[model samples]
Target: MEETMSTRRRQFKADARQLLDRNFRFYLLLFLPIFIIMIVTAVPQWMNGAGVDNPGYNLLSLLSIISGLLTVGVSFVLIDLQRGVAELTEPVSKSFTIFNRGAYLWGAFALEIITSVFTILWSVLLLVPGIIKGLAYSQAIYIYRDYLDQGHKIGFLEAITLSRKMMDGHKWEYFVMQLSFIGWGIACVLIIPIIWVVPYMNQTMANFYVNLAAQEDESDEEPTVVSPVDDADQSTTESKPETPADGDEKTADNDDKTE
Candidate 1:
């Protein structure tokens, strides 16, 4: 009992340490460049069109749409960063270099495009399918992380399935974890606190995943161990033979002699 408690405590410490050590600066770096790019393209157009009917205002709106599309793609980058931080939090930390920003960005773009089309088509019905698709696709960053290192060979559908599976039973935990950082995110409205906080939260979440992943591995390994009864069965099978033992042979000989 004491040993079990100590092991749990050690696991908690390791998880906490993993979260604390995630490289906040890297995520901040990723968030800023994309943010700056979006702002450069977006704010100017937004500011320039304060009036109701400027001819260029239509153009500005188009630009805004385009910027929004790109921003959607940027989510893939966020996902990649988040997953990277999470993978680092394992009992044994894996080294993470910055991920391929370009591929993730484009993948995000393509996904957004396809989903957008589906959403529009499904607009005839209620919005439930669209919402589910959005959540399903939300894991692209994790998908990219698993695939990018291996030369992009994994089937896209398979990656999606795996991410969804990883998220199973943990979706609520994930939602709460994201909510934990919402306060910091609100602070970013005034300044760039998100640069630090976003990465921090992402890494913290990554740590959570690591802990959960470890628990899952442990659970899987546990059932494989044989119980004492099973061990006894094996012992009996190994030691006893089906062929006539001395008592059985003597009985048979007596029966044969009698016959």
Candidate 2:
């Protein structure tokens, strides 16, 4: 039976929860640096809330960029961990390994900028369309990673286009999947809970991508079809008996005469 979108979403979350239950401590440690980066970035914005010109704003902006780039790494790590390809022992190093590859580091940065601009542009027209576009492009980073895996480097625009294609019928399901995390989002207001919630949400999103990619791959494959005429021909060829040679016929005739 074909699984419904709701069923798949539930399964993704369930799998993520099960994985987390087994390795919550490790996952938390993995995501702790990102949480700290986010908190540090937010501090300047909070300080600037009064509209006063804060000198730290420039530094905060730099930190924000760093955070965003590191987030791409974190996403890669979580996705790898979800797919069972990443080691659990060196979570921090694995997360930073994105920086080791210039192509991935820059490609991820470019993709982030492109997707954000496009989403913001759509949002400028209306809130719903922007939200929908955001959901549609949510898988751009994952798609980029896939391209890297296949040794086919693609531009940020192309990656976004592929993500939009991959997400054609899944925007609502993805939206709802994110919406279901409202409770966790609320709990993160306490600050410390963010370490737990961040990894959980990232892992669940990774599961979502894994399932969606598998479905897309299945759909892309063409099934082999056998024609009835061809089947009949093959069956006849297999069932037909071999004709006897002249020697055999002569021997049979001789045997009959002798009998």
Candidate 1 residue 29 Cα shift, in angstroms, is 4.1
Kindly give the stretch of ten consecutive residues in candidate 1 with the minimal lDDT sum: 250-259
Q: Which portions of model 2 miss their true places by more than 4 Å? A: 1-3, 50-53, 190-192, 222-259
Model 1: per-residue Cα lDDT over 1-259, one tens digit each: 4455346435544554454456444444444544555566666666656744344656656655555544444343333343342232221112112323566555555655654564455444646544443443445444444355334344344444444444554544445455656776788877755456544554455445444444443564321112222233443222211222333211212111100
Score every model by TM-score.
0.48, 0.77
Per-candidate Cα lDDT values, in order, are 0.44, 0.69
Deviation in Å, model 2, residue 218 alpha carbon: 1.3
Can you give the lDDT of residue 246 in candidate 1?
Answer: 35
